[model samples]
Target chain A: MTDNNSGFSDTKQEIMQATYDAIQQHGYAGLTIQSIADNFGKSKAALHYHYDTKEDILAAFLNYLLSEFRETIQIDEDSSPEQQLLDLVDVLLYGPDNSSSEEIFQMQTALLEIQSQSPHKQLYRDQFTQIYHWLGNLFVEIINNGIAENVFRDVNAHLTAQHLLLIIVGGILNRHTTNSEMSPDQIREIVTAQFLPYLKK
Target chain B: MTDNNSGFSDTKQEIMQATYDAIQQHGYAGLTIQSIADNFGKSKAALHYHYDTKEDILAAFLNYLLSEFRETIQIDEDSSPEQQLLDLVDVLLYGPDNSSSEEIFQMQTALLEIQSQSPHKQLYRDQFTQIYHWLGNLFVEIINNGIAENVFRDVNAHLTAQHLLLIIVGGILNRHTTNSEMSPDQIREIVTAQFLPYLKK
Candidate 1:
C-alpha cells in the first residue's frame, strides 16, 4: 500500500516538473494538456485526471512557488525591523538560485494571460491579492520596527511597503524585458546602493 | 502651389488625428483603413496617399510622440548630470497625456498580435530601438553627472541606468499586461520614491 501511494505521488511531482519545463521552453501560448501528456508519454485523459485543465496546472505551479518562497523566508518574530527588511531584500534579491529565468517568465506571461480570460481571471485575482497582502504586511512589520527603534521616519508604512514591492517587482520585470546585460550580482549591487541610502538610520 | 501644399498638409494631420481617435474607440482588432477614412469623411484612396498602409499610420503616430517628446524636453547641452536626470524623469513621467486607456489597449494588443508578423515587426522594431536608445542615453547622462558631482557611489553608472530604465519600462508593460486596478499615479509614486532616494546627496 505504501509503495503504491509513493509511486502515485512521484508521478504527480513528475507531471508538475514536466509542465514547468514545457512552459519554460514554449511559453504560455504553447502550453496544453496534450503537450504535457505527450511529454510524459501518457494519455490526455491521464493528464486530465491529474489536472482538470491548464488553469489547474497553473494554479498548482503558483501554489508551489508560494510555498517555496514561504520556505525561503524565515520571518523571526524577535528580529529588528532593519534586520527584517534586509532579510526581505536578501530573499528577493538573493534567495534560492534554483529559480530559473524561464520559469519566472513563463509564470508571469501565464498569469497575465489568465487575467484577461474570464472565470480564471477571478482565480488569478484572488491569488494576486493574497501575494500583495502578504508582501504589504511584511513591510508594515519592518516599518513599525524601524520607527520604534528611531531609525525610520514617521512616514506612512503602507505606502513605503507598497513602493518597495513595486521597486523589487519592477526591477525583475525590467530585467526580463530589456535583457539588461548586468549580471544578477551587479543588478543587486545597484539596487542596494540606490535604495539603502534612503534608509534613515 | 505653396498655399495648396499647406492645405494638404493640414488635411493629412486631420486624417491622422481621426485615425488615432478611431483606433482608440474601436480598438486595433476592429480598426480598419476604411473606418478611419469614414470617420473623417475622406476617401480610402486619400488616406492611402498619405499612409501606404495601416502599419504606416501606426508608425507615424509613434514618430509624432517621439518628436513631440524631443521638443517638450528643455535640453541643455551643459547641464549637470543630476539636473539632466531630473529633466529626463520629468519628460518620461509628465509628458502630455496623449494616451487614453482604450488607445493604449488597442495599440498594445495590435502590436502583440503582430509581434512576429513581417513588415509590421520591422516597423515596430525601428520605433522600439529609437525609444530604447533615447532611454539608455538618458541613463548614461545621469551616471556621468553623478561621477562628476561625486554624489553617487562609484558604481557602474551605465549598467545602473539601464537597470532603472528596465524597471520603468517593465512597470509600464505590467500595466498593459495585467490591467490591474493600479493607477498610473499609484505606480508613479512608488517608482519615484524608490528611484529618487538613490539620487539624493
Candidate 2:
C-alpha cells in the first residue's frame, strides 16, 4: 500500500511511525534499526532499502515533526487580538492536547535528542528561527492592537515579543528537562506579574 | 606527572582535554575516541587505555566541565549586592570572556548534544539541576537583599529566582543555537522591562 492517494509514500510513513515507536521504547541511544524494522514484522533489510543510516530516518522524522508544527501554528482569523495572543501562548507552552503529560515529556525529550544531532543543528536552527519569526510578527500585531484599544501601554513590541518568546521557550524547556508543565496558572501568573508591567500601569 | 598532585592523573586530564577539544572542533556527533586522540597527537590506543568507549570519555568530559562550571560560578564577596547580581547575569549569559563567540557557540552546542543523550540524561539532569538550584538560591539571597535595601520591591524571592534562572538558561541556549550573544543591552532591557515589575516600581 505505497499509497492509494497522498503526498508521501505510505511505506515511508509506516517506517517513520515504527522509528517513533522504537524511540519511545528504547530511548534515542538505545534504538536500533532492527527494532524499527521489527515493528512492522519486516526484515531489517526492509528498512535498509529505504534508509541508509540511523540519522537518515531520524532526519525524515524531524521533517515530519516540522510539518506538524507548521500546521498547528495557525489561529482562526476572526479571533480578537487578545484571544489570538493567548492562543499563541497556549500553543507554544502546551504540546497538543491529545498527548498525555508523560507522552509529551517523552516525545519532547526524544525531539531534543534529534535536535541536538551535530550535523543537523542548522536544520533545527532554521526551523526554530522560522517559528520565532512568525511568533514575533504575531506579537507585534497583537501589541499594536492592544495599544490602539488602550489595553496595553506603549511598548517596543518587537523587543517585548522577543522577551516573551524567551520565557515561552524556557517554559517549553522545562517540559523536556523535567516533566514540569507551564501550567495555565503559571502562564496566567507570569503574564500578570511579568507582562503586566509593560501592559498596564 | 600522574603523582605531581591532585586526585586525577595527568594522563586523565590529557584525555579529558582532548575530548573537550574534539567536541569544540567537531560537535558531539562527529567526535570519536580516535578524533579525541588526534587532538593531543596521541594514538587511539592511548584513549582506549583510559576510555573503553566514546560515552565513557564524554561522561568524564562532562564531570570536568561541571567542576570548571562550579569554580567560575562565584562572585567576589566584597561587591555590593547589585553588582553581584549583574555579575551573575553576565556569567550565565556571556560565558567566560576568553573564548571566542564561535568557540562558545560550538561548546554549548556540544553540551546540548551531551544533555540529550538518553542513557546519560539523568546524569546531565543532576548536574544541570545542581547548577540551577545553586543559581536559584543565590538569586533568592540577592533579591531578598535588594528588597531589604529598598532597591527592589517586595517579591517572592524563591519564585522570582526560579523565573530569572529559566531566562538565564534560555539565554544560554541562544549562544549555541545561533551564535547569539545575550548582550548587555538585551540583559539591561530585560531587567528593565521584565524584572523591574519585581524590582522597585
Candidate 3:
C-alpha cells in the first residue's frame, strides 16, 4: 500500500500534474521538491523516492508534453492529408485550452532554463527537431493539396508550409508576451487573417 | 590614477561591451564576475565598481542591444515614411552578414531568461511594445501611400504588417535553430514572393 502505488505510471503522472500546477502558480523559480511535496501532502523524502531531483521531474514533464504533441499530430488512417494537417495545427495552437496555456508557458520557460545548463538540453533539442521536421512534412502535404484543388498558386509547397508553421509559433510567442491593449480576440483575428489566405483552398 | 581612466562615460561603454562579449560567450548560467573581469583584463573588484552584480551586467548588455536596434531602424529625416519602413524591414531581417548569428540568438535567449525574473522586465516589455506600434504605424503609412498611388488592394495595413512581422520572425528563428539546409536567402525569397502580390501598387 502506497500513496502513489496504484501503479508506477500512475505515481509519475500524479507528481507531474502537481509540479505543473505549482509552476503555473509560482513560475519555474518557485518549483522545488519541498514545495511539490507540500502540495502533494507528502514529505520531501517521499517525493525523492520517486524522483531524485527537480530536474528529473522537469524531464519527465517535458517527455509528457512532447509525446502529447506528437500523438496529437499523428494522422488518422482515413483522413485526407489536408484534414490531418489542419487537425495538427488545431492540436498545437488550440489544444484543450482549459488548463494548459499558463502551464505550457511555465513549462516552456522552465525547460529553457534547464536547457541552458544541463546535458539533458540535447533531449529537448531533439524533441524540437522532430516537431520541426514533422511540421515541414505537414506543410508539404497541405500545399500540394491546395494546388491540386487550385486554391494555391504554383509555389514551392515545402517553403510555403515552413513559413506558415513559423508564423504560427512565432506569432503565438509574440502574442503571449505582448502587453498591448489588444484583446485576445483581436490577436486571434490578426493571426487568422494572416494565416487564412495562405491556407485557403 | 584610475585603471585605464577613460572618462566615466567611455568607461561605462567599455564595461558594457566587455560584459556583452563575456555573457554571449558563456551563457548566463556560467557567467561570473571573474569571467567578465578577465574579459576586460581587470580585477573583479574593478568590474563590480561599475555594476553591482551579474544581473546588472546582463541588464546593461540588453540596454546596449536595444539602443543598437533602435539606431538601425531610426527613421531618417529626408526619406519618405514608405522608404523608412522598407529600410526597417531590411535592417531587421537581413542586416550585415558579417556578424555571427549565434551572438544574436544568444542575446534573444538571454533576454527571455532575464525578463522572466528581472524587475525591469517591464522596461523590456515596453521596448517591445514600441516596436510593435512602430511597425503598425509604418504599415499605416504604406497603406496610405498605396491608396494614394492606386496600387494596393483593400487590405488592413496595420493587421497585414503585424502578420508579416510574425512570419518574418518565425522564418528567421526556424532557420536559426534547424538543420534543414535552408539558407536565409531562401527564406527571404519566400517572404518576398508571398507578400509582394499583396503589396502591388
Isolated chain A TM-score, each model: 0.71, 0.71, 0.65
Top of the candidates by TM-score: 2
Question: Comparing candidate 1 with candidate 2, which one achieves the higher lDDT?
Answer: 2
Q: What DockQ does candidate 3 have relative to the true complex? A: 0.37
User: Candidate 3 falls in which docking quality class?
Assistant: acceptable
Ranking by TM-score: 2, 3, 1
| Cα displacement (Å) at residue A54, model 2 | 5.8
Off by over 4 Å in 3: A1-8, A36-53, A70-91, A100-120, A135-143, A150-155, A181-184, B1-8, B40-50, B73-90, B101-120, B131-154, B172-183
**lDDT (Cα, 0-100) at B19 in candidate 1:** 70
A52-145 per-residue lDDT for model 2 (tens digits)? 9887777677665555655656766687666777777776555666766666656766666655563355656654455456667878888788
Report the interface RMSD that candidate 3 achieves against the true structure, in angstroms: 4.3
Output the number of the lDDT-best candidate: 2
| Worst 10-residue lDDT window, candidate 2 chain A | A1-10
Alpha-carbon shift of residue B190 in model 1 (angstroms): 3.4
**Interface RMSD, all models, one decimal each?**
5.9, 3.1, 4.3
Candidate 2, residues B85-172: lDDT per residue as tens digits? Answer: 8778876655776767577667767776666663245656655555556667888898888888887777777667766765665555
Q: What C-alpha lDDT values do all the predictions have?
A: 0.60, 0.67, 0.61
Evaluate model 3: give its lDDT.
0.61
Residue B108 lDDT in candidate 1 = 50
